[model samples]
Target: MGQGQQEKVATSLAGTVGEEISASLAPVDAELAARYPGDPGTRQPVHTVYVPGDLLTADTVRSWGDQALAALDEHAPDAASLAAVLGLSDDLAGPVHDRVRAKLRQEPVEDLRVDFEDGYGHRADAEEDHAAARAARLVARAYADGTAPPYTGIRMKCMEAAVRDRGIRTLDVFLTGLMEAGGLPGGLVLTLPKVTYPEQVTAMVRLLDAFERAHGLAPGRIGFEIQIETSQAILAADGTATVARMIQAAEGRATGLHYGTFDYSACLGVSAAHQASDHPAADHAKAVMQVAAAGTGVRVSDGSTNVLPVGPTAQVHAAWRLHYGLTRRALARAYYQGWDMHPGHLPTRYAAVFAFYREGLAAAAARLARYAERATGDVMDEPATAKALSGYLLRGLDCGALDLAEVTGLTGLDRAGLEAFATPRRGDLTASAG
Candidate 1:
């Protein structure tokens, strides 16, 4: 092998990467890279507050969810003051408290998961099912009373070989109790945690379909969420991504794929003390999850921050700080939703969420508006940019962090479009006719 300078052949080199490159991306492909929650699933909540089934009651919304509203109310002197407190931009001049009150009253727990798994723990089967039934009754009452959150559901234990039947039974009994008592809420979802195989998701879909058929519920009434906790769920022994397989197996009933930070980290042998949202392994898994769910009508949610906001007695600042940091991490990963174990996490959740949207509002809105008008600009905007832009705004609005007025100027979407942003593929911010 003679080492000599070869005659000058055209040498390839990396080109400049910036807003221009990113702008040209299609919404779907761009979402894969940016992790924006697309227009597939229901509007993601600011957070999913999971309460143990036993604690739920027909009137428990005030007790359980009010604490979160209180958390906001306490810090929020008014909309402007609260915005300043949260470091939100000046554009948020309206009354944030009114939004907080509406959220508290209407859908404080935009997505409420009655946990029979980790949050509830392995208790007596009878006791667990009874609690589940009770939770269903509460949901029914809430629905009848017009107090139901926009999205609500239960988190069953893992569908492992050891307890598959039990998980299925609990889910069935809960649904049975719910339907017989009053009726199912409009946004009923079931979360199957620690899923290790696609077969598990398929099994759940079958179970849900049967329930819908039997109870006169719509065919796809029982949307599902999978916990990507196990290593196998992310990658198979054959080195293939199983997350996609799981979604495919859901057969159109799949809605959410939630990451389990602590469980996943623990499985990888990380000490309990060290496991957190930003762990490299967790990041890689969530990235894989985001890519798998992109454009498939499936939403991705990050895991919870085990660090509760607490001090000697009801500490707020420390909890807020921790929640803000954890939430910021999740947002950076483009996870618009995650689990909330406590009420104190609410304030920080909104603060961080609002900040995230505000920080990018100017740029994103401008790009989106230009894309909608001419479909070309200083930054290339594809159809994908439309979805991405609309999704971003919808997530913010759905969570009460950004109002329509705050977004309209930048997005060039009217009130109708803003209202429809939360609906599935409705109110598409990009208009060809425009």
Candidate 2:
């Protein structure tokens, strides 16, 4: 046969050696792809309302948010500047107020963490255990009565070397009691504070496995979150990514990485006078958290504003202003979920969250409609963008920020389209299995 016109290049290896190079790269790609922590449920709540363990009851959450509502009633601002501070577009001021009131009355606390870590401080071990067990019973009762928050859980003490045993004991007692009374509620997960090592996460996983076995629940049924309080949780002693190692150690059980305001700042040796969520150090840590947790399905939560709305009664305006300002700042940074330390923070929380959804509702809906109309458009319509847009709508509907009619009317998307948008995205299947 006559040789075809071929342009030959110099080769380092003969024959099928080139094929071996491609073959070798496949296993490395597979190993790297295996490291990803898959997506979490999109319906995660926007805030966790923490109350002292002893003080939390189903009725407390159901009926406790009236003070903030009354404050809003009395302070009907006429000035545009004040309205701006509270995130009120003149068009939404009244409806937003009504929605805030309705949200407080209907579901004041979507995620309630009966705090024993900082909100409920150190006490005698036996007394702490007793409180936890008692709280567990109340939670179980709430579950039976359908009064529990949609997401409810407890925050045990720090699980460091100093108090690991005590923390474990309290966790065991509370969970055991909860299991005996009624199994855990939907979205129930433990919160482990002061995580500085991957071993802590692994130990927690092992402990949860033990509890599930003893209680006869399915393995991996108990999930927990780690608090990124110290800088060590962001960077390990040997200079590895602490967040990555911790999630890997969780063995598919870690759901969140909650920021701790005071503890984190104090760990950095910042004085109380300068300690705030907006501080540069805090921002750096939160940025680290966001970067580490992004695409890993691990939620990142901002810490609470300790500047609570407690008053000489005259200082209510100032307190609300500060709370609202801080909330707006956090929302700007994509930390939709945060902490509410008091009942009085509820009005501002709802007000800020509603404003966030309302402010962007127009743009998001238009973009979503435009993107949905065509498979590809000028705006990127990748799986992640679609997921986020759908999730934003779902959040509004679930939290009553927008009614079904409002969402459909605005987005030009029907119920089916919204539902399809909310479904988790499956990864690309074009790559061959290695």
Candidate 3:
């Protein structure tokens, strides 16, 4: 064959391969599409709160769900009572079952997260002693008995050296227990802590893979989240290589990378006696995580503010909550899902979430709309692409989403180029706006 003909044949083969790959990836694209189905203009934030049982009294724990109910009354009244879900410890259940029952009687959150750290902590033998199993059963029974809190599942110890040392075997044992005891709650979320490298996340994934094989569970049945706590994970030891490896490792199964501000500061030699969240080091650490997670579909969530100053007067409490809301929104705008440690933090959670969506939707929609019209075209109108890209810079700046330094980093179009892009053409570019 002539060289030209040979090139043609090679092109044909490459095209065929591309088609096959696209066909295979169709389902995956469909899943991602469905996963984030809202219009960019109306995207609601996914606010997943963490409730620690130790934070509340048993009487308070049982009576605890009222705040969630009140929240539902405000924003998503018909959306279901998800905020009230308990993170029941084995100890909490004995004291607060009835109080929890009263709330469950109203409407149960979709899933209840049982804190393994509270009960099991570093005890590898807790799995054998059946405390973990019993907790699962009690939660299951609560659901079965109509006093149940929707879905019941366990949150294993992610930070404890026991699981880290056992590696995948720890998860193996937990999965075994869940299976032998019938099944898990609605879902399993492995809360990873002190994650300094991507290898830690990869290890978790391998364990999930092994668990699937051992228990006959389908692939991708398990989901995990990394607590972006350690200084190494946030600020790389070897320039950007560590952060790159971290993002690469966290790509698939990671739903979101959560900020462990407390632990992160602690790891940085911040005194445990010091208030971790308020520390400047903590702010810088979270910002690092935020920047790392930018444009990555993996959602970023800020850690709890942790100042539960519920006081004497309603006026004083309201003022405190208002400040909390403003702070929460600021954090959310910085690209984070707000973490509600206390039920009282519900006000802040809703406020921040609403503000994020309200602002994010409008900003994304405006920028995307401009880009869609100007820069992103099929043919010779590539100059329009420059305009659209410039719009992103303006939108990011206007919305407080990105500062000038970050904007320059994102676009790489220097001041001169940006100025040229911003200047309008004489006639042809001017279009009618209805």
Candidate 4:
């Protein structure tokens, strides 16, 4: 063919074959789009603070912040002290300590859940109803007065036959209270605990659907986290992955899958001392949950540690070390969120998170910068790698570990540009560089 001429091409099949193929795959295309809508591109909380429903006051957030600061003051007063406890190097100790302190002061708890489940235990109907309504009123007022955490809600009882009706009633009372207090806050979150079957998830959907209709809210406005506590929630009797089906059964209302470390481990017959977030069973369940939720607009949260950083300074330091190490491990495994049970856990939570992002910030920024500029380096990165790199920085920024100016200066890409790469669509993946 000449330079200015086009080459002729021959086809083996009829022209209508192309249309026939498209028609045949149309349903599949729709299914893919519907099932895998991708991440919602929102800020996922790094930790969820669970307080018993009756114990949650308007001052709970501030109280946690104060207690965390006090713990730091008494146990790890300086950077060197904290560094010694958590085994941080000289470079990270100072910055991590400063940021953790600031985070405690500014936003102690990113997400707060008033627990009506195991944390609250089973209570009488009247008492539980009052607590649920009280939670809503307090949460609403906190949000109104700008004192609430970024996210707040209640974790109602499970859908087990024993507590199903009570759980529904609590949710109803809570939502009704919120509706009466005004509308639901944008940060409102709900957790349906101890979900063992997909049918329970579907039932939750039906209940939320009814609530939305009764309140005249938009369809699917409310979404809840599924608490995977039972062995059946992870593996069905038929040996199938039940968590995946739970996500499907949610019908687009499953916001997250939270691993219930203690409940799940107990159900698997793991002894009390062996029931930890880093245990093999917990890892297996969370791994299944992570794979099931990937690209499905749902987040996965690890469970909590019962070890509180209390007692003497040595004991406190030991607990802090344990918590810090587990948090770092979880972060490396892509579990960005977990449960924080005690106020003393706050300092270590932020420390582990801040250190994780800060330690990798420069490398991630450089790689992303190179990718954005289409430059070659020792490590050649593709679109997916770029996505991961940008995602790392974005998560850092979201959690206050990295600042916008620092990221922009290092990568030469603003927040919008980074977000574009961080959440690219299916088509964008192919022509991302272009």
- What lDDT tens digits, residue by residue, belong to model 1 across residues 342-383? 876766676677677766778877876776577666766555
In candidate 3 the C-alpha lDDT for residue 59 amounts to 28
Clashing pairs in 3: 142-148, 143-148, 375-384, 375-385
Q: Best candidate per TM-score, number?
A: 4
Candidate 3 per-residue lDDT over residues 1-434, each given as its tens digit: 77666443334366689889999999987764444322122121333444432321222323435764454344333212222222223433322333323333353233344454433354546443355445545544554456543333444556346565543344455566667767654444556666777887787787778777877877868767677767787767666635446655754566567777677777788777674455788677666666665444455666666566354434335543554554544454554344445555544344333333333443443443344445443343344444544544553343333355644554454545454564435222445321
Q: Which stretches of candidate 1 lie over 4 Å from their true place?
A: 1-38, 69-106, 216-218, 312-315, 375-377, 409-411, 415-434
Candidate 4 wrongly placed segments (more than 4 Å): 1-14, 430-434
Lowest lDDT sum, 10 consecutive residues, model 1, at 424-433
TM-score of each: 0.80, 0.87, 0.56, 0.97
Clash count, predicted structure 3: 4
**lDDT values of the candidates?**
0.75, 0.79, 0.50, 0.95
Q: What is the lDDT of residue 320 in candidate 1?
A: 66
TM-score computed on alpha carbons, candidate 1: 0.80
Q: lDDT by residue for model 2 over 1-434, one digit each (tens)?
A: 35796777787767688789879999976655555535555577778988788777657776656665665556633334336556477987766777887887778888988888778887898789888998899888988888888888889877687778888888888888888896777768689999988898899998999888887889999898889999899888898879878878888788989999889999999999889889999998889888887767788899888887766555666777778788879988878788888777888788878877777787778777776775455676655576678778777777777778877887778867886776644453123212
Please give the clash total of every predicted structure, in order: 2, 0, 4, 0
Identify the superior model by lDDT, candidate 1 or candidate 4: 4
lDDT score at residue 408, model 1, on the 0-100 scale? 83
- Top candidate (lDDT): 4
